[model samples]
Target chain A: METSAAGLEKAIKAIKIGLSLPEQDHLHRELEELLGWLEPLLAFNTGETEPLLFGHEAVNVLREDHPQEGRLAELQEAAPNFAGGFYLVPKIMD
Target chain B: MELRKTTVRQAADAVWKGEITAHQLIEKTLKNCSVLNEGLNIFTYLAGIDAVEQAKAVDQKIKNGEKPPLAGIPVAVKDDLCYGVLPTGLGSPAFSEFISPVTAAAVERLMEAGAVVIGKTNLDDMGQGSTTLSSPNGPTVNPWLAGRTAGSAGAAAVATGVCMLAVESDSGGALRQGASHCGVAGLRPTTGRVSRHGLNAHCSSFARVGITAFSGEDISEVLDLISGFDERDAATAVCREGISEIIKAPGSKDITIGYPVTAFDYLEPELREIFEQARERFAEGGYRIEEVDLGLLREGLLAYYVIAMAEAFSNHARFDGIRFGKTAEADSLEEMYEQSRAEILGREARRRSIFGAFLLSKDNYGRYYRQALKIWEMVRQEFETVFERCDLLMLPAARSLPRSLEGESGFLEGWSEDLYCAPVSLSGMPALTIPAGQVDQLPVGMQLVGPPFSEKMLLAVGSASGSTGK
Candidate 1:
C-alpha cells in the first residue's frame, strides 16, 4: 500500500521523467513522507472548534456491523481494462 | 437595454418591476455571452439547458407574483467551482472532457435564491495561477483592453463588461489582486464567509471563493445569499452567519488607518506613488492615517506557491487515470501513471508540483514551508496588531502596472506579486480593492483590508472610495 525509499525513488525517477523532470527523486521523497502523514488530512473539515482537517475526524464504525451483498459481479462486469482481476497497463522498466 | 450594464440588484429590480422578462434577460445575456466571450475567453462552458430551464422557472415565478433575492439575475461562476450542470474542469487538460455529477452547495444556494446560471468561467490551470493567464484554453483577457491580464486586468475589465457579476475563487491574490488590476471591487471574506464544499481544492488554508462586481454592494449582496452553515462542508464555520446587511458606514471620520511604510517599498515606483496619493486622499477625507511597520513580506509568493502547490499536487492525485481525466496508455499498472502524467499536466501545473515537492520535503519543509508559515503568522499578527491601533489598512493592488502582452510577470514574477495580497488571503481576513483612477490612462486600484468577517465594514469603506467616481 506504501512505497519504501528505493521503491519511492524508483517511482519518483519514473514520475520525474514522465513529468518531464518537473521534480526529482529527492523532492518526491520529501513530499512522499509529508504526504504519507497528510493524505487523509488534505481535505477541509470543521470537527473541532477551529477548522478540522479530514485526518482529525474520529473514524466511526458501523453501529451494527453486518455483511452486505457485494457489488462483485457488477464491478467485474464493468472492467474492460482488467486482467486477472486487476486493471491492465503497460509495464515500465528501469 | 439589454440590462447588461446593470448591477445584480438593478437587474433584479427590473425583473421585479416587470420591465424585463427572465427569458428576455436570458436571451440578451446569451447574446452578450456570445459577443463578448470571443475576445475575453471568460466562460469555459455555457449551460444552455440549465440556463434556459432556470430562466423559464423564474418567468413563471414572476407570473405568480413571487419574488426571490436574485430573481432573474444572470451570474457566471468560475469553472472549477461546481454548479451541478456543467462539466467542471479546473483548467486542467486531464478532466477537460469530464462533467460533474453533483452540484456544489454554493451553486445550489445561489440558484435557490433565484440567480440564473449563465455559465462556468475560466481560471489558472488547476487554479494554481493568479493572473488567469495559466489557463490551458488561453488567458482570460481584460474586457476593456484586449489581451490584458484578467485576474490582474480582467478584474477591472470584468467590471467594464465581461459578466455582470463574476464568481472568482482566490487561493492567494486570485480575487482581490485580479479585481484590483481589473479596476473593480473584489472581496475575500474571512474563513467560512462562504462554503467551500463544491469548490475545487487549492490550499484549503489559503483558498476562498470571492466575488467581483462594479459595486461593492453586489459582491456583499451575493455573499449574504451564499454564506451560511452547510451540513456537507465541515469547514463551514457555524459561529458566524453572513453579514445581516451591508454595513452602513458611509466613510470613516476619526478612524485610524494603517499604511505600511516598509511594505510600500515593494511597490514599483509608479505603484508606490499611486498608493501614496490614495493614502493622502484618505487623510484629506477626514480619516487618520498611521505608518504601521509591517515587516515587509519578502518571499511570500515563494511561500504561497510551495504551500498551495503541495496541497494541489495531492488534491490533483485523485485525477489519476481513473476518477477523472485521461486514463494511462500503458501495458501494465506501473506504466499507467507515467503515461497519464505526461498527458495530463500543463507547464505551470508541473512546475507547481515540483516546487511543492521540493519545499515540503523533510529537509526543506522546515526551511521553506514552516519558515513561510512563520512569516505568514508574523504578517497576520502585524495586521491584527496594527488594526488594534487603526481601523483599516491601505495598500497597492499590485507591484507593477498592468503588464503589456510583451511583458508578462512569467511564472516567477507571477508567483512574487502575490506576496502583498497572499498574506491577506491566507489570514482569511476581509480584503477589498477599489480603483484609484487611471494613471497615465492606465487604471490603478488601492486595497483596504479589514478584520475577519468584517466585509460589511470593508465594503462600506471601499464603496465610499469607489463611489468618488471613475
Candidate 2:
C-alpha cells in the first residue's frame, strides 16, 4: 500500500526534519518503498513474546553517583559555543 | 621480503629476533598505502608521521629485549573507532573533522600489546551499508577486481597487504562480507565480547568491534589482544583469559555442523560449487554435516533492518550541530538542526532515520518495531534449539560475487548481502568467516557460528578446517 502523502508529511514534521517541498516529495516515494519492504513484519503475530531490548546477557553494571572529573575540556571543544567554562546557546528565557 | 604480506605472528617474531626494525616495517606499509590507495582507496586518514613515531617506540622496546604480542605490526582501524590522535570521519561529511578525545578500550589494549596504528580505513557512512559505498569519500574499490565494491574498506586494506591487521565493526555482516569479498578472514565476536566504549553507536545493540586479517591465526592473535571485560562498557562480558591459547592445532574431535537450506537457496552457482567442495572436504576430514530447517530465522534480514533503523533514529538524534559535528548557520535552533543534518548526513543515513521514526510512530510501533523485536527473539530461540543438535552452523558468506561498482547506483537497499550473517548478529553469537576457497577467481567464504563465548572452539574448528593453514 502506498503511504499517503499527508501521512508522510506528518511523519516528517514529527521527526523534525528540514526539507523543501520537492525533497519531501522525493522522500515520500522512498518511504513508501521502504514501508512496503517492512510490510511483512506487520503480518507476523508476535503474541505474548517479550522484546529482547539488549542482545547480550550481562547484568546491569552500576557505579557510584559521586561527581568525578569528566572530559570537560573535550566537551567544551566539541560544543558549538563555550566561554568562561560555560556553554552558550540561544536565549531560552526570551 | 614482501614486508606487506608479513603475518602478525611473523612480524612479531622478526622484530623480536632483530631481523627487521618496526621503523622499516612502518616505512614499507606507508609505501604500500601510497601505491595501493590509487586503485583501492582503502584509508580515509593515514597516520603518516604519528604511525612512524609509534613504530619507533615499538622498535625501542624491542632493542631493550622486550617483545609485545603484536610487536611492530602495522594495523588499520575503521574510521569510526575513537582514536585521540586520528581524525574520525565515520565515513560521513558531518564528522569529517571530528577528532576523538578518547581511544577505544580494544584499541588501547592492542597498542599496549605492541601493535602500531598505521592508518584509519574507510567504511560506509556511520556503517549503514554493507558495500562501503555510502562514504562521502569515494567508494573503496575491490583490490581483487578493480571497480567492484570493497565490501569493507578495512577488509580491502588487509587483503591488499596495506595493513597486517584491521580493526573494524559489524552491524549487518559488514565485517564478514568485506572479508569474503577481499579473500581474507574476519570475525565478529559475541556482542559484548569486546568493548564498545570508543566505538560510535550505530545500531548499538547489534554493533560490535570486529577483527580482520589475512588468516584465522592472525585474526585470533588480534582477538586475544582485544577481547576482555571493560568497566567503561557496562555490557562487556566478564574477563575471559586464554582466548589466544585456543588457536592451538585443530582438534581431532568429530564435529557436527548444521546446514540450513533456507540460507543456501540464494547462493549463486559458483558459490554453490564452492560450498559443495568445502562440505566434501569437511566430510573427508571426518566431520558430520546435518541439514536443518531455518524456520523463522529466514526472516532475519527484515528483523535486523527494522531494529537497526529504529536504533539509528535514536542514536543519530544527537548530531544536530548543537553539540558536535559540522553545523550549518541558521536563525532558529530547529532550523540549525534540520539544515545541518540535511547537509551533512548521506542519503542512506537520512532515509534510515526517517524510516526508523516511521516504524516507531504511535500507529506503527506495535505493528512494526515491536513485531520485529518479537521476531528477533524468536530467531534467537530458534538458533538456541539448533545449536543443541550441532556443534556449529555453516552457511555461505555472500550469495554471489560482489556486484560491480559501475553497474549500480551507490545506494544499497534490501540488504541481501547480509542474508547469511545478520541472524548470528541478532542472536549476539560469535561467527568467524574463513576464505573457504575461490570461485571463478572471486573469493568465497563459509561462516562458522557457535553459542556465546565460543570464540576458542569456533576458532579451533576453523583452524582445523584448514581455513587458517595453521
**Which candidate has the top score in lDDT?**
2
Over 4 Å off in model 2, which ranges? A1-4, A64-67, A90-94, B3-5, B240-253, B409-414, B466-470
Docking class of 2: medium
lDDT of 2 by residue, B331-442 (tens): 8777777887777667777777877877787777877888888889988988888888877788877766876777554233437677788888888888888888886667
Q: Could you give candidate 1's per-residue lDDT for residues B1-470 as a string of tens digits?
A: 43435667878888888888777888777777777778777778887777889988988887887887788777778777877567777787776656565677777887888888888887887877777777888787765466467673235335655356667677777777777666778877667667777788767777777777776867767877877766556555443343443343545675777888988887767768877788888888777889887663544444455568767656666555644456766776556766676566676666556556555566556555665555555556667787788777887767666555456443556666776787676555678878876665466677788766667878877776674212
lDDT of model 2 at residue B271? 75
Name model 1 segments beyond 4 Å from true.
Answer: A1-17, A21-94, B2-5, B152-157, B160-162, B240-248, B407-410, B467-470
Residue B49 displacement in candidate 1 (angstroms): 3.6
Instruction: Quote the TM-score that chain A achieves in each candidate.
Output: 0.30, 0.70
Q: Score every model by TM-score.
A: 0.83, 0.94
